[model samples]
Target: MAETKTHRVTVAQRALLLSWAGVTDLGRRRETNQDAFLAEFPLFVVADGMGGHAGGEIASRSTVERLQAVVSAGDVNGPAIEKALEQAVGDIADHPETTDEGTGTTLTGVFFAITGDHAQWVALNIGDSRVYLLRDDRLVQVTTDHSVVQELITAGKLSPEEAEGHPYSNVITRAVGASELTAPDYVTIDVRAGDRFVICSDGLTKELTDYGIQHFLREHRDPGHSVDAMLAAALENGGRDNVTLIIVQVEDEDDSSSPIEDTTE
Candidate 1:
C-alpha cells in the first residue's frame, strides 16, 4: 500500500459551515414592524411587539438587546439563558409603557452551539411566536402556541379546528412585559444534518398551513427567498397581521463525528 497525505480542516471553518437568513414584514394593515429579534452567536430570537404606538417596537428591541448583552457579558447555557430572559422580562415590564395596560411583546429564542460531533439547541418562548422543525419533508411545530385557544384546546374544551376559527385566536395567554414576572417555556433538541428550523410570528403561520409551509421549504433552498414567498402568500390570503420569519438549515458539521455541545456554564 502507498502512503497518502491527509488534510485537516480548521475548527473555524467547521463552526460556521452552515448558512441562514431571516425576514420580517409589517403586513398590509400594519404601518410599522413592531417585531425585533437577535441572530448573534449562540442566540437567535423573533419577538412580536404589541402596543398602540411605537411601544411594541421598543419592547421587542429591548428584550433582544438585554439578552444579547447578558450572553456577551458572561456564559450562555440553559440556566443562564433562562435567568437572562427573566431579568430582561422584569426590566421591560417595569417600564410604564409596557404594562398590562399598554405595551408588550412575545419572544421566541433559539440558542445553539456545535462542538465535535454533537449539537444542542434550546428554545425559550413567551407569547405566541412559534418555533418549528422540518424533518424528512414533514413540518412539526416544536413549541406550543401560548394563546387562549391553545389553553382551550389543551383543556379539551375546543378542538383543533374550533380553535383555529375562535374569535380569541390571537389573544395570547402569556407575553413578555405584560406582567412583572413571566416564565418562558424552554425546549431542548439534539441536532442532525438535514434538519431545518423555522421561527416566525403568528402572521406567517396563520395564513399558511403546515403543508403549505412544508411545500415552500422543500421548494426553496434560500432562507431569504423562502421568507419572502411565505410573506407574499400571506398577503394573497389576507395580510391581517405582521409577519416575521427566521430560517436556519443545519448540515453535517463533518464527515466524521456527531454534533457537539458545551453544556458547561
Candidate 2:
C-alpha cells in the first residue's frame, strides 16, 4: 500500500475562512481512473466520466481543465462555471475520440463567493456525483442525482435502497460533454465554523452506505484522514468504479490562521 497524499488550502476572505483536501483512487477494478478533480481554493470540483476505453478519461479531464482555466482567469461564480461547462461540452464534442453518440461526465463540487461581508459556499451538480455537508455531527447530501435511478426514486417508482442496485443506476440524465449545452444545479449555503463538506463520485457511495459514510466522517476530524478512510472503505467493500473525493472543513480565521499544508506518499 502507498502512503496517502493530501493537499491543504486555507483561504481567509472577509468574515469567512476555508480549509480543504482532496483524494482520488483508480479503485480495485478500473485500469484507468476516469475521475478528475480540482482542489484549488475558492473552487473545488469532481468530474466522473462515462464511456468505455479512453473516452471517459478524456471527457472528465477536459471538463476539469476547462473549469480550472476559467477559475484561474478570475471567474468563480455560478454563471462563470456554467459557461465553462458549456464550453467544455463543445470542446468534447469536437474531439475526434468522442463517438457520434457522445461521451459524458458528471460534474459536482463547490465554489466560494463573497456575499455581503461573508463568503458563501456555492454547491453545484450536473449528474450522479454529489456534494454533502456535515454539521453538528450530522451528514446531509446537498446535491440530487441526475441519473435514471434517481428519477425513479423521485417519482416514487423506486425506493432509495432499490435504486442503488437498479439496472439503470449509472444512466445519467444530465452530464457535461453529453450535449452542446448542460445546465448545472446550484445552491448557496450558509457558511459556519466547523461545517465540513464532502464532494465525491458515485463510486464511493456505491460501496459505502450513507450511515457508514456518516460514521466514518464523524470519527475523523482531519480532512485528509477522513478522505483516506472513505477511499479505503470503498475499496475494501469492492471498488466497482473509480473513487474520488474532496473534503473541505470551514474554520474561523480568528481561531487559527494556519498556512496551507501538503503531504505526499
Candidate 3:
C-alpha cells in the first residue's frame, strides 16, 4: 500500500510545504519480506533488513520502531538519529529470534529541518540502500553504497557495468545492526521548492536503473502515483529482493516558483 500526506511546518521562521508517500513489496524470490519504512514529516526512512527469516524482519521492525519514538518526541538530528540507532542496536541484540550473525538493516532517507536560519534537507545512509534528488529536471544519486562492489569501484578496480554482475555485489560493508555500530554518512542540502527526493532499498535499484527511476518521476507529478509506478515497475522487472520506496517533494508554501538547484554539501 501507498500513502500520501502534506505537512505544513516552519523552518527558520519560514513556512514550507512538505509532501511524501511510501510503499514496500516482497519480491518474487523472497520467502519473507524483511523491509520497513516510516514516511512521516521531518523524517522519511527506508530500511532493508538482512540476515535470514525472522532475524531480518525483527531487525527492521526494531529500527523503525525506535526511530518512530524520536519522531513522536520531535527531536531529529544527527545525534538524535544516532541515539535511535543505538536503541535499535539494543533491540536487535535482545530479540530472541535474531540469532544470525549477518542480521541487520540498511537505513537511508532524507529529513527536513532548520539549521541556524535556513531550511535544509539532511540525507543519511548506511549499507547499499540509496537516496536520490530530483531538481531542474535532472536526477542525481545523493548517497553512496557501502558495499564490496562500491569499494572496488572507488578503488578503480571495477567498472560500473561489471560491478552490477559481480558475485560480491550484495555484500554490504556497513549496516545498522548485525553486532556492530556504524555511523551513517550525512549530506546536507538547501531546501528548495519543486525539489523531489526518492529513497529506496537496494531492491528497487536492483530492478530499476537510475534512468528508469528518473523517467517514472517525470511521468508522475504526485507522490503517490510516482511511488506506485516505481513499485510496480520494480516488481515487473523481476523483484529479486524485498523492495521499498519513499517519494518526498518539497514546496514553498508562500510561493509557486521554480526550485533552486544547488549542489549538496
Task: Give the per-residue lDDT digits (tens) of candidate 2, residues 33-68.
Answer: 999999887788999998767788889998999988
Cα lDDT tens digits, model 3, 7-52, are 8765434466788999988999999899999988789999999887
- After superposition, candidate 2 runs with Cα above 4 Å error: 1-16, 253-265
Worst 10 residues of 3 by lDDT: 256-265
Task: Predict model 2's lDDT versus the native.
Answer: 0.81
> Can you list the residue pairs that collide in candidate 3?
none
TM-score of 3: 0.94
Lowest summed lDDT across 10 adjacent residues in model 1 is found at 1-10
Ranking of predictions according to lDDT? 3, 2, 1
What is the C-alpha lDDT profile of model 1 across 1-265, one tens digit per residue? 1111112223424542344677777888888888886765567789898876777887787777777886697566766666766776666666766644557789896777544455577877888899988877778988988889999999999999898889999898787764545777888887545677888888888889888888888988766677777778988888888888777766544642444343332
Count of clashes, each model: 9, 0, 0
Question: Model 1 — TM-score against the truth?
Answer: 0.83
Question: What are the lDDT figures for the candidates, one per model?
Answer: 0.73, 0.81, 0.88
Give the TM-score of each candidate.
0.83, 0.88, 0.94
